[model samples]
Target: MKYPALLPFSELVNQLDQFDSIIDVRSPAEFALDHIPGAINCPVLNDLERIRVGTMYKQVNAFEAKKVGAALVAKNIALHIEEQFLQYPREWKPLIYCWRGGNRSGSMALILAKIGWPVVQLDGGYKAYRQHINTELSQLIGQFQYRVVCGTTGSGKSRLLQALHTQGAQVLDLEKLAEHRGSVLGDLPSTAQPSQKAFESAIWLTLRKFDSSKVVYIESESKKVGNLRVPDHLISCMRNSACISLQLPINLRVALLMQDYAYFISQPNELMKRLHYLTPLHGKEKIRHWQNLSEQDLLHDLVQELIEVHYDPSYLRSIERNFPQLGGMPTIHLNGIAELDFLQLAERLLAE
Candidate 1:
């Protein structure tokens, strides 16, 4: 059968609600790295099969590789039909794509059309959708006004961002999206961060939904959040945007760090390993001192020392240099890290 009708990525994004599902027919690894935001993986060739087919094409010939790949694609498509598409009505519609406007998506799209469902292949496939996101993001990010949340470590900035989001204030929580806290000890316990492409996709998905006229609150972060980078345009906008500097008592900040990082206290060995990353900056002697404190269960004193000697100095330098607008930025001081303190702070921020 001839290949199915092709829909441009731009048009597909607008009419996304009409489709029952957006199916990605690429290998699992490709989909894992990135794909359309709402698209589900329905690989015509799984990862192992793809590697086998590529090796065959390289060592043997195209015809022999196609022969093996065709059988695998047919079985996978039949399984998808039986397991996934069985409940869909005859008139159901789905948009399909692969890495490029190619045979993989074409094969499944043709079969779905024959089964009496409307299926359209993405014209340039995932590549086109990715390009669209990159292009659209530059414009979308520029349209919004931003209020950057800035503070030293353990000043309750992230918690305040969460409260603001819960209170219906517009917020872009970069750390939540990156799954990292933007610091040396930022990595979550066992969770792995997303691929750079997937991270960009998450940012693009969020940017499209925000109302441009309203102020979007975000935390001040370095160019890179863990391994993934904040989009260049977003970083630039945030650095130039207005700032809200949060302040808390040093003792309270130390207590907040203990609560936030309670896991480190329970796992002394892990805490020791994470502290080693600071050796280059603070010297072996200082790092050893911190390690000894962790081993002796002296987290309160250790946290206070780190805050005063490490985090605060770095934060001050970064904010002053990167965010020029913050030179005379308004400050919000908090007496405690309790829920009530943040709630009142959120209300005040909203009023300003």
Candidate 2:
């Protein structure tokens, strides 16, 4: 094969494993929004430089912008070669892309090719890949049979998914992918959610790896998880699919929630701040009461009240409205929230 061969989106998807590295040459800001899975950013023009070049292109002339862009691209590529790419053997193959199959990626591909490394440049670049994902997700989401796990808050839906996954079941834990537990207090301390595009990319990648003939277990999530919106087609498919209702005793549910949200207990002030978001719905007085529970270290009482007052009602309403099929679904009742309990439940589910 010729060095620096240009491959279209179709070929690039099939031949992904052939490349040693997937390098994204767009600005870091653009890369952060979304890139091909496993692709590393090695921007030819960084965020600020990209802005400067784009401003020049609009304010000055194409010729002038190209001159400045060329210089910036050349310098950045040189630095990357020195700092990052110097250790690669001659056999190292890389797939490179930019916003479009344009100069930024082209310049890097040309340099790497000149150095005798095999390179594949993605034609139509990240834009084409994005389009491919959109098309694939639209079609692929409907191919598999989804088993939506329905439960009230603190009912161990996510834990059930984890257990199912351990038992070799296909499970799409959207909350895990989104890094949020899908509630007002769902935010994880010291962890941030991925961008919407990144979240969708994660969903796309996971779906691509599944066997379409097998049933995929998933949680009954809303259209949004944390700040990220689940793709419309995926959410739609899940809503229309079969459901498995998960239930635990209220005591167990509270214990599970307390375990899952231990960070809040340790940091009562943060818990108070999160409870404040409920003010509009519960009124300031009710929210203040919950906050007082947090301050008084009445976490068990607080969790139980939150479940009864906020989560259960909201979840029941959402599930009833969104998942009509849940009217006659199989319900799995658990006595305890132990690992062995979930594992046994997962085995029974799979056996059925």
Candidate 3:
């Protein structure tokens, strides 16, 4: 019986530097939560069969376990190969992996290789890949000099991050996924928020793009923002990051908020709709007070006040609670407005 060469996880990652497709043959539920960068889900066994086979293997011998398990694996791969992998060129080289690079991945690799498609089996499988990834991430996140932009409501952290990106600086915009601004009005500006698993996956993907040797600008945030909570992996990274506070005048912040939140101007109904999210923190009376104000700017002002009172304090408390003092957090004061545009801010930061 001829079998393909089994690759060590480190070698697989190095190969990932060259190959486009690295597949995880685990159940969708497992793959959905966390997966190797760019790997797609093509399960050899669904959740139920996986559980059944594990139970059988524990109770009986390998012969009986293989009897039932082999059938399911063969059927699943046949269906997937016909539907998914059959389109590949005969020369296509794809690496396959499972939990241990054990029976499941071995079976798939041998079949694919016999069909004349080049196959690589990840030795020790997805577990090895995950161990490598987690270790690498922990080291990279700590080693990098991260710049956290801290500010009050409407202080333009998101815009500043965008501006930094335009200027060719590395920046991570957490609000982009949370779809909320981390304040009472946080939910007002967007409708699409990813699940917690998706949120970490996105963050991990973005961080993986840049060189860990340099600085990446990110917004200061609490642990839980919107419906998605920041994963412990990211929380650990942010805890030790170098932070800089972006201070702007409340009036300017209010103006910028109105501008950034132009969608709010279009939907007056949203003013009340999103206001409900903060009802638990702030009662209806304070909300109505802002509503009663004649000027929209006054309403914006009230919104800012509500943020400083409720959101900012909580954020700062978390900061204090998490780290008594953030080491190497250099403070850059933005008292008067910046003379340079977003591009210029990026230039200045990159030069720093």
Candidate 4:
């Protein structure tokens, strides 16, 4: 009278906060493209085997697939368990999932259970987790207090957000959202951004962790940053929300941007399109100097030219239009030493 230890996805999620290991048994490829925030991949079928079995199942029949797949699964399971999961303590509770919590994850868990490891397979697998996360996300965006950060390009906006986060502020980096760094030179060295819907979902999930009655600090962003668009309601909240402005000197702004964006120095042509956003401000010569820079000498020259011609003017315009002398308190400015001051400032603002 042996049966699988079955559990619903909701119960699994409720149990998720307690489990140390959330193991995905649904092939490495499936795990890589996107996965639950902290889940680890230990597939019972590698990508090639999964594809082979899938083709056999579709092109022939389930019997053919099952016959061939069983041997492959058994081999992979032995390799994965021996090389990977065996190191965990016996008390370690692992949540296992496959494409549908069918044979793949169930078989792995059964084997683990025999080894005296406590393992439970997700009832409906990753699709269930995706649904659960989305449901949580949809509920969050409406209720959170979004205090958006409004500033121009090269404003040290993301750095300030990170510093504020270090001081225990609830902050969201939208550049991290679109996976594009929100500029022409924004592509990461070796990472692809998430799908648009998933990006929104992650932002919503992060925001939900904060107190709704209090503010959630986020960077100012347009509706579109590369391929991702901020959800309309959330964007509206950001635009209308009362915000704190962080103003830095043009030299400091340019220097911070140069340091943060290593790719621009390495790939000068990649930054040409950003010049269009600046052309209305800097005229064409500054843009041309930027265009000409490839070596360290030209890059340094372009950096200086950009501050005088582009970033400074943009910063001033944004400040004048959005945050021009608020009624209650003057906007705070802390030069090179002032970022720490904002932690106290953020706490005080939250207290109000």
Tens-place lDDT digits, model 2, residues 1-352: 8878888988878778778999999998999888899999999999999999999999999899999999999999999999999999999999999988578888999999999998889999999998898888879888999998999999999999999999999999999999999999999999999898889889988989999999999999999998999888888889889998988999999999999999987788888889989999999999988888888888999999999999999988998899978889888889999999999999999999
Which segments of model 1 are wrong by more than 4 Å?
Answer: 1-3
Model 3 misplaced regions, further than 4 Å: 1-3, 48-65, 174-209, 223-242, 255-302, 312-340
Q: Scored by Cα lDDT, where does model 4 land?
A: 0.71
TM-score of each: 0.96, 0.97, 0.74, 0.81
State the TM-score for model 4.
0.81
Give the per-residue lDDT digits (tens) of candidate 4, residues 318-350. 556654443233355646624665566566655
TM-score of 3: 0.74
Residue pairs of candidate 3 with colliding backbone atoms: none
Local accuracy of candidate 1 as per-residue lDDT tens digits, 1-352: 2436787888778787788899999999999888888889999999999999999999999999999999999999999999999999977888999988578999999999888787889998888998998789889899999999998999999999988988899889999999998888888888889888888888888877888889999999999999888999999999889998999999999999989888887778888898999999999999999998888888899999999999999988888889978769888889989988898899878987
| lDDT at 89, model 4 | 89
The local distance difference test score of each candidate is 0.90, 0.91, 0.72, 0.71
Name the 10 consecutive residues with the lowest summed lDDT in model 2.
Answer: 10-19
Regions of candidate 2 where Cα sits further than 4 Å from its true position:
none
Task: Report the backbone clash tally of model 3.
Answer: 0
Candidate 3: tens digits of C-alpha lDDT, residues 244-300 = 666677777766766766776676677666665666767888766656552355657
